[model samples]
Every structure is written in structure tokens, then in C-alpha cells.
Target: MHEPAHARVPAQPLIPAQQKVLRHSVRGQVLDALRAALVDGDLAPGEIYSGPALGERFGVSATPVREAMQQLALEGAVECLPNRGFRVLTRTARELAELAEVRALLEVPVMLRLARTVPVSAFESLRPAAAATAGAAAAGDLPRYADADRSFHGQVLALAGNDQLVQVAEELHRRAQWPLPGAARIRRADLIADAAEHSALLEALIARDLPVVESLVREHFAGNPA
Candidate 1:
């Protein structure tokens, strides 16, 4: 028999050094996308996210997708499966109720301090973000509206004059987004109503009505969500 021809081998694909940087960038992008999906309710609680499918969706390899899922798991946004995959973490209705209660307690009192300390000038500064929220509500961009809604709260928090309270509220607001999907639609009416409240709070502040501001803050959270 004729000697077999030497087997030809294909050269290995070379990933350049810059590929590592690209991989990191891809990982970051994947992280942000998954986070947004979670916040927007596109990734529902208890739903499985396939690493391969996520990789395909973002036009990346599974490595970055897996990495992003792991990070989200650490944040409690998702949970890892044993030898299977990851699933979105669910917050029970009871847990949501408790969070709402805590938010009311922490944030409303903080707003009381802010309403008292916020200058009339700061009210003018808040108008634009407030307007953006109103516009988003009109346009039916619930996520943008949520952002604007949160921004309005942030402006109030900033005026509280307590750096630590502001920081804690800011962080809690981020986590709060997870439970806000259903509330987003409810907030269409809420934003309009809240705009009025914000205006009223400012007016009360200008008038130095501490009781009125406290009442408004309490009312705001009390009616937030069940």
C-alpha cells in the first residue's frame, strides 16, 4: 500500500493580546445588559437564562456571559444552579411588602429633612429632571420614567444635609428597582401626583411649614404600593 500522505493540520486561531481587553469590555457590556434585563422585567424571576443563548444574544462567547451571570448571582439578582445554569432570583410578595415598609420608614423621614433644608433655588434646579420624568410618563417609556422618578427623589435626598443618609438612600434606591416593574405603570398617575407633591413640598419649605412637609413625605410613601 502507498504510504499515507502526512496529515495536514489547520493552524490554531490566535487571539491577540488586545483580545483580552476586548473580552473585558464584552464582559462589562454583558453585565450591564443582564442588569438592565433584570430591572426591566424582561428576565422574569425564576426564569432560566441559558449561558449559550445569552452569549448568542450579545454576540459574545459563553465565557463573558457566564462571568456576568456569576456577578449577578453575587448581587442576589440571580442564583446559580448545580451543574445546570442560572435562574433569576424571585422576591416574594411578603419580601416586597417588607421592602416597601422599610423604604417608607427610611426614605420618607429622610425626605422630611430634605424638604426642610432644600432651598427655593434648588427647586428650580429640579424642574428639568422633573420635566423629563413627566415627558417619559407621557411617552410611555416606563423605564425612563422610573429613572426620572428616582432622580426626583435623589434631588430631594441631596438636600437632606446628611451625607450618610443620602448615600444609604441612593444605594437602596438601586436595589429598589428590582421590585418596581409593576409599580412603574402605576407611577404614571403617581408621577403627576408626585410632581404636585414636590411642588407643594417646595412651597411648604418656602413657607417654613415643617408639619406640612412631614405630612406630604408620609403620605407619599404610605400610598406607594401594597
Candidate 2:
């Protein structure tokens, strides 16, 4: 006897209250949801966010919402109004281009430096992250794909042996996540193509080829074509 069509499908993960709290951390969940909302243009730039209103949307209370907003303000993703509330921050094309340029500036040199020094062990450490990124892309999970991308780049920065650069990369990477919503729509082919680039970078690093690694770094930071 054949199983029902729906029965053949994978079961969804259960979201128990304890698991929900663990996964979301209350504040991080609120922050990420609000950030996604802002980046997706659901909350237009300069639009005031009411804590109670936002809490209602998330089925929580204002405390978490306010905490999220304050975090966003620190990240420059939102602005706080004294008598009003929080407003989404907008970015222009030129501003985004500049941000990418900055990433290139910090990243390319570090990758080049790492390429010269990366041991076989360090290069091997990146294989899991690369595989995970490819898996996320294959699954068409944009957020997970992006997170894996961050992880891959972060491992590279950490391998460079510069704590300050690693910190800088983390901060910049967080800001870069803002542009991803529109960029993802524009470069729909990228998530797949970008996965391949990670492979090239990994191979170049393993080979200890500084020039090839630098070139690959430039290609990776150049952004994806729509």
C-alpha cells in the first residue's frame, strides 16, 4: 500500500514554548523580525514604530519590542524619537556601494594575508561551513544561506589571526545584512552562484595562492548581478 501524498512529506519542527524562548531569546527574535520587516520595506524609513502595536503583531509585550528597538538603534538600523518612537533607517544605492567597497577593503587584504599563512588544518576547517552554505542555498532558505555566508567569511577572518579585523567584519556584516532583502530579489541567481564562489576561495586558500585568493575575494565582494 502506498502512503498518502501528504504523509510522504517531512514533518515540521515543533515549536514548544521552551524551545521558542531558547531559539528566539525573546529580544533577538523581536530584533530579527523587526529588522526583516524594515529591510523588506514593510516598515518604511522614517515611519514611527509603536511598541504596543509591534508587540501585538508579534503576540508579545512592549518590553521585548522596546528592547529590540534599542538594539536596532545601536546598529543604526533604526532611529529613536524622543516623544515619538523608532523609525526605520534607509540606505541609498551609493551608500550600499560604499559599504561593499569597505568590506572589500578590509576583507581582500585579510584574505590575502590568510592565504599565505593558512595551514591545511585551517583550510579544512572551512569545508564544513562551505558545505553548510551550499546546503542552505540548495534548500532555497535565503536567511539561512545568508547566515552561512557570514559564518564562512567569519571563519576566514578568524583564521587571519586578527581579533580586531574579526570584530570589524562582524559589525560590517551585520550592517550588510540590511541590504540583502532588495539585493536578494535583484540577484535571485546569486545564492546558488555565491556558493560556488565559496568553493573557489576555499580551494585557493588551500593551495596557498595569494593572487588567486585575492582575485576570488574581489569577485565575491563585487556583489551578484540580477
Candidate 3:
């Protein structure tokens, strides 16, 4: 029961506070598909994607495409222009290194504290994220892998019971995942190794091996080699 390709589903711009992560809506579906395209390199970095063209590709009107692009803009994934469409933003090696440094400084200690404070059983509920990351890596699906990675880390920080800390971690994490200039060069094996880190970290957390967990967390961020 889907709408026709020519259907013109209208879209409305959302205010900052009202903005929710796109999910379960027509625009949200478009948003997910578009993100996959970006991650798969179907949409090259530094390239511009016109709203109408993208809409046609997704079999909708331009509204949802534009709406999704706007959301991507907020993620620091793209820059929207007045007369032109959105331009994919590129990052430098130094910038990516700095992002990792900031996350190491901000999140490593928080994860360690949470690991120590929360019971091992508290983290058992989050196993699905690790599973999802593994699945995505097996399929070489970068977009799904990124989403699951974000969810896994975000959940770990949320266990610390600090909304503000989670917010900061999420922002920095999203920026760290940006399609840097070297992103296209990453291989499936690299992503699989990345996924393995999550699994290893979770095993340490569940074992209540605080020292090992702390070391794993620090090592993971030391080089987001993915």
C-alpha cells in the first residue's frame, strides 16, 4: 500500500526545538534512503544534489527531499545554499583527528565511569546494537552500520544518566562519522574490524572488567580507523 511515484507529498520546514529525528514518516523514509545513498558513495562527497532530481529518484515530490536535506544539513553532513542544492561537506585529516581527540577527552572517561557505576545487567539490554552493527558490516552497508554505531555509543553514554553528556557525545560522534576526504577509500574489511571493536567492548563491559573496558573504550576512540 504505497503511494504512486508521481505523488506530491507536501513537506513543512520544522523549527529547531520541534525538530525530531526523521523516522516512520514519508520524509523520514526519504531521509534514510538518501543517507544510504551518501554512505554508499552513490552521492559523491563535494557534489551537489538538486532537490527535484533527488525527489524523482525516490519517487516523491521535491518537498520531502528538501526536508531530508535540511536534516542532513543540521548533522553537518551537507551545506544548503540559497539558489543551489545542498553541497556535501568534506573534512580534513587534521579535523578528523581533532574530532577523535575531543571524543576521547569527553567520552572515554564518561564511558569508564558508567561501566563502573552501572551493573553489568544494565547493559544487557543494549546487545541489539552490537548485533545490528555486525549485520551491517557483513553486508557492507555503511549507512546502517553508522546508525547502529551511533546508537550503541549513545546508549552507553545514556547509561551514565546524563542527558547533557549524551547530547554532547552524540554531536561529536555524528561529526566524527562525517564522510571525510578519505572516507571513500575505506574498505569492507576496515568496517568489519570497526564492528568487531564494538563486540569486544561489549564483551568487556558485560564481564564487568572495568580495566579492560576502559582500555577498550580508549583504544576505540584513539583511532576510529574506520
Candidate 4:
């Protein structure tokens, strides 16, 4: 006897590549959402959040949420608790200063070097990212501002042709942007000033003004909190 149509037409399982792509997509979404929450102060530092709870909040399954949290843990943004959940790590003022110092150490020289050698078009290309930061700052969108800020800096460093330097500098940038418990929230004015500095720095780079570029980069790392 022949099987029924529904039984005969069995669903095709996803191939390994497709499955991997899907998993990575979901993981990336969850990670972005989690980072946005962290930046916007929606996820309080020192507060523990369970994967299932955050999954429900993000409209995904616990698997992706846990994966995102694990990545965050590796980034020093959170800590994994045995049988509990992930806690947003509270950073001290000293820790933030140190991160800023390290980032400046890694990036300032690159910016100075790129200023002398990289073409004007390369720096000009980053204008949009700089503008995005300004817009986000004006709108008080902390998450967008943070992402744009990182993108601008990363683009600047990428011109140096050192992928490792870009990665390390961006990691430090991300760590520096994390919220500190009991600390005053970064004001909109501060964000705007920081964003404006990006434009100034871009202009200096495009003009190949090494002295101005170095000063702007150093001041930026010293003053920018997010």
C-alpha cells in the first residue's frame, strides 16, 4: 500500500551550514541586544540575570541567550555564577582609567602614524560614523552612541592595516563603555562633546595634522566615558 501524501513528503532537515548560520545569527542578535541593554543602563551592573529570563525578554530561546552571556563573560562585561546566572560586572574608577590608558597607548600612535601616511579619503570615509555618534548623543540614545563611537574608532585604527591592533583597541573601548554601579550616569552634554571630538579628530587626520591628531586622540580617551 502507498503512504499518504503528508507522510511521503517528509520535511528536509537543515544542512550543517544552514544550522550553523542560523545559530550564529541568533547568537549575534542576542549579543547585540544584551550589549544595548548594558549600554542603555537597562541591565544594571551587579544585577544577576538568568538566561531563560533574558531569552523571554529578547523573544528567543535560552540557548542563544546563554551563548551571548558566555561571550559577554569572556569580554569581562559579566561573570558566570555557578547554578545561578550572569552578573553584570561592576567596574571601578581605577579600572576604567586603566582601560582608557591602555586604549590610548595602543591607538594614539596608530592614529599619529596614519595621520601622516593614510590618504585623506580614508579619514573622510568615517564621517558618517562620526555623524551617527553625534545624532545618537543628541537623541540620548546611549546604545546607538556607543556602537557608533566604537565603529568610528575602529575604522580609524583599521587604516593602520593592523587587524590585531584594531581588535585589541575595540575590546578596550567596549570595556570602557560599560556602566559602573553607583556612578553618575553620563550626561547628554558629555556625550555630545565626545561626539564632536570625533569630527575634530577626523578633520585633523584628513588634514594630516599630526600634532592636532595626537592631542585630540589623547583628550578623547581621557574624557570619553561611553
Leading candidate by TM-score = 4
Ranking by TM-score: 4, 3, 2, 1
In candidate 1, stretches whose alpha carbon ends up further than 4 angstroms from where it belongs are 1-28, 161-164, 179-208, 222-226
Q: In every candidate, how many clashes are there?
A: 0, 0, 0, 0
lDDT of each: 0.64, 0.70, 0.74, 0.82
Deviation in Å, model 1, residue 145 alpha carbon: 2.1
**C-alpha lDDT of residue 108 in model 2:** 88
Go through the candidates in order and give the C-alpha RMSD of each one to the true structure.
10.6, 8.8, 7.5, 10.5
What is the Å distance of residue 115 in model 2 from its true position? 0.8
Q: Look at candidate 4 and tell me the lDDT of residue 124.
A: 85
Query: Clashing residue pairs, candidate 4?
Result: none
Q: What is the TM-score of each candidate against the true structure?
A: 0.70, 0.81, 0.81, 0.88
* Residue-wise C-alpha lDDT for candidate 4, range 1-226, written one tens digit per residue: 3211121111232123234457788888778878887876777777788777676565567788899999999999989987677888888889988988898888888888999899888888899989999999999888889999999899888888889988988889999998778777789999999999999999999888989998998899888969
TM-score for predicted model 1 compared with the true structure: 0.70
Model 3 misses residue 162 by how many Å?
Answer: 1.9
Model 2, runs deviating above 4 Å: 1-24, 38-46, 180-187, 224-226
What is the C-alpha local distance difference test score of candidate 1?
A: 0.64
User: Can you tell me which runs of candidate 3 are displaced by over 4 Å?
Assistant: 1-24, 182-185
Which pairs, if any, clash in model 1? none
